[model samples]
Structure formats: structure tokens, C-alpha cells
Target: MTNRADLHTLTGAYATDSLDDAERAQFEEHIGQCPACAQEVRELSATAARLGLAAAVVPRPALKEQVLRSIATVRQEAPRTEPGPPGGTVPRAPLRRASRWALAACLAAATAFGATAVWQHREAGDARDQAREVQQRTEELASLLAAPDARTRTAKLAGGARATVVVSEGRDRAAFLATGMAEPPRGKVYQLWFNDKGTMRSAGLMDPERTTSALVMKGRVGEATGMGVTVEPAGGSPEPTTKPVALLDFPA
Candidate 1:
């Protein structure tokens, strides 16, 4: 039988259902006389249940067999003490202390597992969102390419470079391809522009290292009357900073 002081230490194991039959019976008898031990046991049991629910997972087919085999090989601790004639027996203080520490470790493992599961779930959701975004972009680009009225126009640049523009009939979408463009002077990049009437807007920057590159222009392509490319500072300017190396004008 576990004494009143030792009963408190077994509360954690009792709550987690880890205590052996004898230890459990002894703890229950002690708790009946100790209000504080009873309350603590109840609280710990509730906490363990919550942790169990959060960490619940389907076990593999062989898990049950593995667990049973493991239990069979393990040696069970002897009863702390035999009950006296009328009163309870003295508890093995060391064993009771070890049981409490063991229960704490088990709870910690469950908590950690629960936290890891939550993080992985969030990561999976983010990956799905990214995949959906890429798919949508792919579909939009495909639709633009399949448009019946889609047409391509090519322009020769000063340095034997070539610029090709593909525009849909509605002029709502466009793609630009550049090839053989000589590397820009140091501290400069090739910048694309869309001219709507007289208003110039930046499209995007070209890759300096690539001899061939392509860009799918965003926004309303129909609003632009013409397109041009110029060499500008590395990051590109808000407006054209140099004469265009090549330009393509759309039919009215």
C-alpha cells in the first residue's frame, strides 16, 4: 500500500493508466482518504486525456503485435508493499518517485508529437496553395497561346539582336521573346516598356546573362499602342532612360 505522501507521486502514472494493478489499487485506497491527492489525480487524468486526443493517430497493422511482444519481454515491477492487517503498508518512496518522473516524460513526448503534427499540416497546406497558383498561371498562359487571333511580330535591334512580340486578337494579353541581345553595358539591364498612346509603363526586366529570354507581360495589353526595349540601370527606371534598341508598333 502506498502512503498518503507517496500517493501524490503515483497520480501521474495513475492518470496515464501506466500503473500496475497493485499500484493502482493502493493509490485508489490512499486517494479515498486524501482529498488533495484525489483532486490532483483528477486534474492529471483530464490533461492526459486531452493530450491523447490531440496526438491520436492510426497505428500500423503490425503495431499491436509489436506492442504485445514488447510487453511480454519486459519485467513488471513487484508490488511496492503488501497491505497490513488493518491499515495500509508503507510505500517504496524511490519507486513512487521514479514513476512520477516517467509519467512526466511520457506527457512531454505527446506534447512534442502534437506540435510537430500541427507544423507539418500547415506546411502541407502552404504547398497545396502554391501548387494551385502555379496551375492557374499555366492555364491562363495556355489560353493566351491558343487564341485564334494570336499573332507574332519581330523587330531587329541595333546590335543584331531580335525582339519578337506575340499578341492576342483582343490585345488583352501579350508575350515577348528576345534573342541574341548583346549583353548590356556594365551597371545596366534591358527594360521592357508598353506605350499606351503617349503614356509609358514599365513591363519588366530582361535577364542579362541569357542570350534568349521570354516574358509574359501582365496587366491590360490592349491599352498599349506600342512596345519598346531600352538599356537602363540594373534595377530599371520608372521611365525610359535611354533610346530604345528595338520597338514594335501595334496596328490601330
Candidate 2:
């Protein structure tokens, strides 16, 4: 039941595969008939793929040739024959056949090594992308906090936990921070909402397993008057299904 506007805001997350299964399904259904959202998702997905590729290390053109050459040049040692009864030796497999087997084994090993190298490089690239994303979010959060019009409000929640919201209308963004938050009951999560007049809009969600920290909400602040948090089934509800644990009003 996510509003159409909030559903549209999920294109980026869907492109990055960041949405939980439920949210992903919801977005998928939304995009089936919405050409605009479908197009945006496609573009964002392509951009994300390009970013991943940008971080990948390209191997030298000659590297494959060198590996093949090395495999081709490998000398196969003769198999040792076991001693047999009465001054005779057990017959060994044909040298040609043994050599072919050895070559095949070498080729297989080389192929496996190549695959491992590629996998490692991709993993390194993913790590770099994650680091860059973290840095970018950190910078954004810092700017939001330092905005001249920034105002912060804190409210106590259940179990003595507290929520602190830093909002900067001038920047059209807000950040949510929490401390002493205990994990929600099994199968439930904390969902954030933007109070637009009396109509609440889905802000985003807090994963039950992750540490609740500074979160820059998913979309523009617009003229939202306040923010609130409610417990919802895992993956969140389109609207708040429970009483808000905490609510904070923006500074006038």
C-alpha cells in the first residue's frame, strides 16, 4: 500500500538490489505497467553495472597467451612402474596416454586458477564500491548536519532507547539516528514515516538486524511537518500499522 510517490522513490534501491524480498516484489509489480519507473530502473541498473565494471581490474592482453603457453610447455614426468614378482615389472600405462592426461590436468588447473583470479578481482571491485558508497553517505550526512538551517530533535522510545532526528529543510533532507535500540520482536521491524499534514508517507525502514544509525531518508523533505516511527511487519507496511514509538516535530 505504499503511495505511488514512495513506490517511485524505490527505483534506485531496486536497481542496486538493496530492497528486501517484499519490497522488491512490490516495486516489480509497480514497474510492470509504469513505463516511467521501469525506464528509470533500467537506467539506474545500467549505471550501477557500469560502476561495478569501473572498479574491476582488466588483465593484460598477453596474460591469457602466457598461461596457455606455460600449460603447453609443461613437461610430464614418466610414471613409476611397480616391481612385480619373478624379476618382472608391472606394465605402466602408455607414455602418450599419461602425457595427455597430465596435459589435461594442467589445462584444468590453469582454467580453475584463471577463474579464481577473476572472482578475486571482482570481489576487490565490490569492496571498493562499498567503501566509496560509505564515504559518500558520510559526506552527505556531514553536510546535512552542518546546514545553517539544520535543527535536531530527540525523543525517547520504548525500552529507554532514543531517537534523534536532524532535519535541514534548506537542504531538503533529514537524517535519523538512534541509540540503545533493541532488536524488534521476531518478524517485525521499525518503519519510518514522514508526516505530511495529517497524511503519513513512508520514509523508509530500519532493518532489524542492522545497527540503527544515521540514515538520510529516501526522498525530498518537501513540506513535511514531522517524522515518526512505528513497528511494522518485516519489510514494512505501506502505512503505519502500529502506534508510533516516537515522533519529532521539525523546528519552525
Candidate 3:
């Protein structure tokens, strides 16, 4: 149904009893022509005669000459080219052209369909890979949330003008999502940090597009009592460069 015209020859082949009714009728409609159907019928005649011969009795040896002479006469006779039953011309030339074109088109279409199917299969495989990576990252985040000695907190990281904080809590183990008035300079990244009383530990990295309510880092951490974000160098900084962009008072 995706391509109605494509089923014509297959239907023609089918209508001659080579295929069943559904496919035969479908292809006939697909061809949208009468000459194609007639050609298919004619081509099928020899095959039908072969089927009939299995049950036929052998002719007497004396009749062989008579049968041969009749065949020769039939071959020499001119084929009738009168109009068909519907008063339509029994188109011989058009039928040949249409069938050849239809066959060529079918072959070309089959090749294109095969290629498209392969490409889509590859794309689906790549998507599955990406999905697997995301699932792994979520598992890592889950482990961090379930740490037996885990400490939780939220902080509004205060930067130059405005700030945002990491909201890591509960089974979700979310991270820095919102932001206040601050911008990372060129080629710099916003790094997530968890301050345990005195030492600042890296939670992960954040990007402008990574800002979301359920934000989480692909890595895991432990004993994080407070959350902070800061403008760090390209990858990340060993320590916080500026004040906290946002801070959250996590539960002990």
C-alpha cells in the first residue's frame, strides 16, 4: 500500500495462477492497465498447456504427421489483431513497453528499499547504544544516592550577579539545574562540587544545556553534605575559582 503502483507486475504474475487472488488483484490494480494483464495471460498459456499434458493420452503414431501439419499451419497464419471484447484496441506494442518499464522500475525500487531498510537498521542500532549509555549513567547516579554514608544538602551557589544551586535529594539524586546571573567565559565549563565541611570534592561537570530540574552527573560521589557550582577552566578546576553560584543546605 505504501506504493500502489509497485504491485502491478507481481499481480500480473499472480493473476495467471502463478500467485493467489489477493496478490493478483492487487497487482492488476497496481498496473492500472489492461494490456499488461493480457500479456500475462498469454505468457501463462504455455505453462497451462504443460499442466494439461500430464493427464493427456499419447496420440496414435499415425496421427503425428497430421498434428505436425496443423501446427505448421497455425504458425504460418497471421495473428488476429481485432479489437478486444470491450471494443478497446488489443495493444501489442504498448503492452511490451509497459511490462519492460514496470519490471525495470520494480527492480530499481527493490534495490532502493533494501538500502533504506539497512540504513534505518543501523540508525536504530546507534540509538540503542546511546540509550544504553544513558542507562549506565543513571545507574551511577543511583549508586551515589544510595551510599550508606551519603550526606545530602542544597546550596544556592552565589556568583558575580546571580546564582543557582544543586538540588540533590531523595532517590533521584539530582544535581545543579537552575542558574542565577552568571556566565562562563569562553572555553570554560561550570563544574559541580560538594563541600564536606572544608574540602571541596568534584561532583561532575555541567553545561548550559544540562540545566534541568532532574539534573544529574554521569559520575558518582560520596559524603557530599553541600552542593556548589563554580566557573572552572576548560575541563574542571582543582578548587573552586569563585564563590558558589548556588548553594543548597542538604540534610545530614
Candidate 4:
């Protein structure tokens, strides 16, 4: 028998959906018999619920459009400035100083905004380039994930709508990297599973954004029965929920 206090400790992880298979089973066994543990889980879960509610109900503060309008006001003001009455003779010294200040302000704004835009452009370009590299390299190394000599593979998924997988292979084990996958719907996940015969074996549940990497926990020849990929509900189905998108059945 396990202590109820120990079981209470698992409550946080259980509520967060972070526990692994064996831990889940152990937690379940403890919670089922201990009403105290169940109540504690409920109380802890309620605390978490409050945290989520606090986050969601946070007032947007109505600041976004206001800030944008503030920015625009400055942009428009750049073109309009207080000047001497048109018919009056203006002092040349003050005019020169004003002109110099205006020119300096324009240059300062240009430098700041220009640098920002350039930086944004460079960052986006780098992301695209990285995505491309991940795809290309994953494609190349995917074939070797199960090969004894293979090293590593990685892929970046885009949106929950599309998919990408990268596998890095080595003699004893492989790393299956998942990236760019959108957050799963509330209770679902894109799971990692292995196929053995007609039966599907669980590898692990995917990460929230699908930027998850699941290391193959066990070693198996890539050429065995067949290697497959599937998308399943969040916690992961006892079995695959849909047809596979890839199969590592070589020499076909």
C-alpha cells in the first residue's frame, strides 16, 4: 500500500497531464482507494482552475488600439509643426535651430524604425531557412533512423493542419523530433506510436505545440514488421485513431 500523502504529490502532474504511463498507473492505483487523495487532487486541480480563470478573465485593458492611435498621432505630427505667423518676420536663428532639431528627429525615427524592420526581416528569413534545412536534412536522415549507423533526424510541422517528422538515427537508438505542430485541441494530441504486426504500440503523447521530440524508448530493427506514424487524440488513443501518413517499409 502507498501513502496518501505521496499520492497527493502526484496530483499536480496528474492534473497537468504530464505523467508517463507507469506513473499514471501508479497514481491511479493510489487515488482509487484513497478518498483523501482524490479530494486532494480535486482541491489542487481547483487551484489550477483558478489560475487558468485568472489568466483568461484578465482585462485586455483596452490598450492596443489606444497605443496604435498614439503611435499614429506621433507619425502624423511629424509633418505638422508650430511655425511663426505667416505674415510676420520670423527670427532666423530660432528657425535654423528648429530646422536642425526637426531634421535630427526625422533621422532618429528613421534609424529606430528602419533598424527594427530590418531586424524583423532577418529573423523571419532565418526561421524560413531553418525550416527548410530541417525538412531537407530530415528527409535525408529519415531513411537512416533505424539503421544501425544512423545518427539523428528532425522535422518541423506547420499548423495542426500539416505535418513534418525528423528522425535522427544511431546504431542503438533514434530521436524523433516533432516541431511547428500547432497546439492540440483541448484534449487531444498527435501521438507517437510504433506498429508491431497489426497491433500498434505506444511511443508517447506529443507536445502541446507539436514541437515535441520523442526518443524511441526501445531498440528495434527498422526493417521489422513495419514502422508507421499516426495522429491520435491528445492523451493518445489505446490504438491509432487514423491511418498512417508514413511507412518505413523499404525495398518495396
RMSD versus native structure for model 2: 24.5
Q: Write the per-residue lDDT of candidate 3 for residues 6-78, one digit (tens) a residue.
A: 4433532553355566766666564566565555544433323222211222334655575577786765757
TM-scores, each model vs. reference: 0.44, 0.49, 0.36, 0.31
Off by more than 4 A, model 4: 1-148, 151-172, 212-214, 217-226, 245-252
lDDT per residue as tens, model 4, 154-174: 222334332222233344233
User: Which is the leading candidate under TM-score?
Assistant: 2
lDDT of 1 by residue, 1-252 (tens): 664566667777777777899998888888898776676566555435433322233445665686689798989998676445456445545544455445544553432332233333367788577546544543454344434466667677777767767678574877676666788888899888888887778888876755555445766686788888889999999999888887898534
In the range 1-252, model 2's lDDT, one tens digit per residue, is 666546766765676677898888888998997786676566444433322211122456877786788787888788685556575532222432333233323322231232234443467788577556655555565455545466677677779776777788778998777756778889999888998987789989875864345556767789799888888998889998898887888766
Q: What range of 10 consecutive residues in model 2 has the weakest lDDT sum?
A: 48-57
For candidate 4, what is the lDDT?
0.45
Per candidate, the number of residue pairs that clash is 0, 0, 20, 14
Weakest lDDT window of 10 consecutive positions for candidate 1: 111-120
RMSD of each: 25.5, 24.5, 29.6, 26.5
Order the candidates by lDDT, highest first — what do you get? 2, 1, 3, 4
Specify the poorest-scoring 10-residue window by lDDT in model 3.
Answer: 47-56
Q: After superposition, how far is residue 105 of candidate 3 from its true place, in Å?
A: 47
Off by over 4 Å in 3: 1-126, 139-183, 213-223
